[model samples]
Target: MQPTDVSVSGIGTYHFVYKHDPQTGESGFSHLITPLGTYRTFSLFTSLGVERLTLVPWALEAGSQNAAVFTFDWETRVPPSGFFQGYPLARFTWPSGRRVNRLWAKRLVVYDNIQINWDKEDLLDSTSVELHDSVNEFNIEEKRQFGAGTLVTHVRGDLTLAGTKRPKPKRSGLLTYTYEYEYDLSFLVSGIRSCLYEPSTASPLWCHRAHIAFNSWSGYSISPLGANHFQDGLSSSLVLSQTGVQLNRRFDNSGRLLTFALQDSKRQEAIINVTFVYSVDSLLPSDMNLETIEDVPLRTHYRRGPGGRIEGIEYETVGSSRRRHVQVSYNEESRISDLRHYISDSQFAKAGSSESKHITTKFLYERGLLSGFGSWKYTFDEDGCLIERKLRDSGSIEDLFEYDAKGLLRWAERRVIPSTTSEGQQKTKLEEPFCNGLENACYPQEMGQVKDYAIQYLYDAEDRLVVLRNTLEIDDSIQFFYAHPQHRNRLTSFFHHGKGKAYFLTYEQQTGHLFTIEEVDLSAAADSNPERKVYIIITDTEGSPIALYSDDKVN
Candidate 1:
């Protein structure tokens, strides 16, 4: 079964141990006896007396069924009490008792104590289970006070997905079983976070230890509960002698963040705080006030729609009479189409407001897409592709777009026309061409343009892009190479033109990921601090892209 976002269910197995009751001369359970099964209806046992395995509410709109089939050993075991009238398994099959090997999962339990496991475990030659949960229904382990045979059974098995077809721990001479499993959250609370109960009465209880969740694989240490868990080695809860920068926070009744105060951080200093306010129906911030951080007061207000979507934001500063505000409006397609700017400084009369005091700028869109910025509007082709854009105030400039049949951008052109007041419309046009179809845009371009030299694109019969270059200048082109030719996007190494500097694009042997160890020339390296040339990116194990440096900073 495919895992859905809502619910998870699993089937399980139970081994009922029984001993001979000397007084009754009958085999009865010494501890954790199975509930008596009565003949409820057609071929059905009434109550198998199981724990968990109940579907109520989200589990199953119907409460609890409290019934199941029995598994017993005809060779040595008693039949469930009062089941001769109910469903029939096999005539004379269990005249003595029932014999079943597998059962359904009785309950799901919250398991936060489970450690991360990427390593495969042998399913208990019988059964192995994967467990990691913040909150989940769990099986109730029934125990009798001082019951017989205190020996706890150690069920050894491989941890595997249920219903997996590999020989069960018993198939291969192993008896493999199959059961589909999917777990989902049941209840999410929004108030003073408290506990929630499982749908079934037999649901067991588990608690969260509240440990600071930090990864040990990375250079991070796990702190004890209640201890400060810090990122970048800065602590807000550490108490040192008479001084500590302990940050504290408070939440409203709706569990929404209300205030962030530095009062507790340094007790001797004046409290520096920021408070958030909201309407009764809004869980989102409506207003925010900052105090004690600067000499003057600073504040911001949020205007929201009936649906709770933020519509505008206004900012106010203590010393400045002028305030800034931004208002947003959505188009028919529910995408942001316009953003308006305004200043509240009483620079004009209330009649209509002065031009400078009113909308300073307005951004517009077409068909739910950004079409223009400030008095400009965009027009699209029949295929809903942007074809042209021009300013509403004046057609001083225009941008043109073209696309291939595959919906890939082929080229774009920008033309700046000289205003009538200037040098009579010289119309300077610049165009950019994009390679199509290939994942890496490997083919380069067709080499046909208003002004160009020769650009050669070489590839095998497989259509893989191998080489590209502009005969005009050696430093103005790019080249590609591959380790796995079939994977077009997987360029093992390539050469890039970094504004005159030739960069060798290669993979880090340790991570098999691409990096540009910009082979800078002496002219480029002449700049400051050579140490900054070495950039460190830590996406070694996980394939996550990182933008460590902002803008054109160092390497």
Candidate 2:
């Protein structure tokens, strides 16, 4: 995937204003953006009592570009009635070019009806309402009111910088952004009506009473469960009782109690005495499934290096979906034969078991090339090339080849059924790289005549194959350089010449295992010093590496 464009309207569109020092040429800057109006609200209602409103703005857009225009609308519904009233709480424009970004929603407006009493203390009996735009589905509506009580609302605001600096391109780095918002709610009542009952005849009564506390600090609590792998943030307590309430009785005393109360006097009192407690607990682990791999056994021989020395050989029974037997053997040349052979019989099914046999094949070659198997029937041409390849119970192919005067392969072709497409045929092109490297000095007679070809060779200082002045192709080319130490038996590769130019890959001296990677970018400014960053990775037995430490020059 390509890196997103750094335009004003792209994914990472947050504008970063830079401040440059004239004397030292050092520069620094901060990111800022206006608030995008998205908020969450908790609403409570009783049949006859007041309805409480708790609004929280979802100010998580800490690093987003400022919207040209923003607005919030809240729609709330009172139970037992179908009609919903919407309130537009706040609207304002933010000043441009501020060093510190602001996510605050200004001029918040809350609509209140005096006839409907709000029960702030009881949230379980409360219902949540969401306000949505009729036109643009992406736009979210913000809540206007805040705080815990029906008669009063409080508003609070806080600010903090979004976390660490942006990462250099193509280098693995972490990006973090912090989000914060101040909350406050003020009390107000505009109008009231009776949607279910006649407004003139219906008597006003308080069904629930609630208490809402503000700015109260509650003690912290820890989770009893063990730590989970998937939890992202630190475990912390959630402040409670900042908003509290007591629900009161609704409707006339003569009416029978239903959803909110019991008939017995003691039962009614117990129901009224019920209280809610909000305590913080650690987030639980995400759900996951585990799958196990079954072990299979077989007899085979392993070869080590170019000379094809028999490193080791083993004979064992391998498990399979069906009953089977395996046999393996090696020739004096240390080449293994019959690597895998599967056999199945029908008579074993009547005996409540299946029967089959398996065999493994191994080979040794002079160089990196593989020789023929020992046990399987095989044939080779005068050039020591495999002529016939076959698999037991499946099919076989006979290769036909023609050679030139120098014994170089020419006009090579394989004849088989048109419908027979084998796995080996599909992978033949992939072996061209190794084959070309093995035949280093052999030049193709018809090189220019071939299409879709690549020149594969190692060019050393002595070669100096080609040189030109102001070469157009060389100027625009991207090059990757790798070097393997001859004496150390290890590889240390580096990347050069690219956008955000850098040096990467400082591998181990013995195993070629990567230990550390350092990246440097010089594309910022001609006069400015290049930025160098280093990341150290530590690996466990399973080859899973964890970042141990990191140091960077960017903010």
Candidate 3:
């Protein structure tokens, strides 16, 4: 049914059909007609359960490149008709209709939101492979509890591929971590419809209950821990047995987190702790306390002015008489106008330190856009893209930039010249001979004195950077390679014309987990052995490189 009145509340619903014509008694409303013919029909007296079935278009020729996939699996085989089967839309069943509580008498447990096929097999796979090697692989196991409904309540994982051969106490300098969760069932808002009287059902919500870690770097294992929960169903405290580390949390009556502390149980001292103090009349934090395993604990107090704008901040450290203060002034639009930082000189402060060591920074805005700050002035286009930045005193361009239609940097240039008063000194400094080991610095500065340098970026049709050349080295540039089928979204190799070197990258997986780079020298002597270097990248759990190891001296 369609409504005659229009409402712009919420997301502003719109009627897509054209207006009806009363003269012709015709309504301009039609169902979306697709090339695929009707595949299923429902009887006039079909059960409402059929509404739970969902069918999606599945084109046999669909692929990443949008080209026809010639090869087909047995499950996705095409028909012999030349016209070709329009699509192979897979049917999926929604779990809402088969929820457990609705059919409690049947004594059956149903996993909420888990898609299943006709065979009652789960479509959502919960397995993940983190790390794999020839000897071992690291996998994480998720455990779900099935009482009223299914909910993940435990997580068990280990990092042991590189630790098997090491001593039990020193397991390849890695940490094995585990997590456990606790949940509580409560009734919460489910649907949003004012006219409908849908009842809210109680569901289980999980919360972190315990975190365990075995740090091989410290040659110690943290034993399993059990924690108690607060009235709000939050973990209140956790204690690690083997390792003398304890975590504690405190909340206010309103369930607002007040403090969280990580303590060394053996010494009965907090290693790191943070506390939030709220104002008596407002919900905002009035002050905060941060205590690390350092010499002193730092306290920051916030002072708010009219409109609840923070006007000042005061910092004080325990066992120290001196304090640091920051004064903030805001414009009419509530934007920070200026900030002044200085050391407070109270009677208990150090004798020599005073407000004389203060630093002030002012911000200038034009039409709601930042125009200048400190000794630099910036010019931006209508779209708020910074196009130029120059020194306010000398009016000399310090940096210039041009962006493409999509706001990606297309050209950039930098001009570095000392101020008029210091040009002579800078020239002398540039011409001065450096010590035996430092010649590249003076050589580069000498070349920069001749003219400004600019760089041009060239991208392919996919908007992937392909070439980069600079004005200083017009004939030499860097070329990137992504031609191979395996290098669709990953960089395969890059050649540096200026350095006469080509570097190839290798990953642990096909398109992820970069692990190594092999550098080859192109300018090496023909008869002599060419110079080559291989660098190994060590990555962490998120597939981010944490360290680089290479054997340059040996090579």
How many clashes in each candidate?
36, 47, 0
Which residue runs of candidate 2 sit more than 4 Å off their true CA positions? 1-328, 341-455, 461-489, 494-503, 509-555
lDDT of 3 by residue, 334-412 (tens): 5677877666546523555344355666889764557877667878764446888776775544788986543456677
Alpha-carbon deviation at 320 in model 1, angstroms: 2.0
How would the candidate models be sorted by TM-score, starting from the highest?
A: 3, 1, 2
Error of 2 at 473 (Å): 15
Q: Residue-wise lDDT of candidate 1 within 137-225, one digit each (tens)?
A: 21111111111222112211111111212232211111111111111132211111111111231321111111123333322221221
lDDT of 2 by residue, 1-555 (tens): 322223432112333344456896644432332122222222222223233232222222334443222222222232332222333221221121111111112211111110111122221122211222122121111122333532212111111111111343322211111111222343322111111111122321111111222322422221111111121122111211211111122222223111111112222231211111111221211111111112232322232322433333332333433322233444333344344434444446676534333334455442112444432234443233444433222233334444322223333333332325465763453224322221121121211211221121111111211111111222221222222212122222232322435444443322334544555564442424566654544332122442233431101
**Residue runs of model 1 more than 4 Å from their true location after superposition:** 1-283, 288-298, 329-340, 346-357, 360-374, 402-412, 420-529, 533-555
Cα RMSD (angstroms) for every candidate in the order listed: 24.7, 34.5, 21.5
Runs of candidate 3 exceeding 4 Å displacement: 1-247, 264-267, 348-354, 394-397, 401-555
| Model 2: how far residue 321 lies from native, Å | 7.7
**Candidate 3 clashing pairs, residues 3+ apart or interchain:** none
Model 3, position 504, has a per-residue lDDT of: 64
What TM-score does candidate 3 reach?
0.36
* Per-residue lDDT of 546 in model 1: 31
lDDT by candidate, in order shown: 0.36, 0.27, 0.45
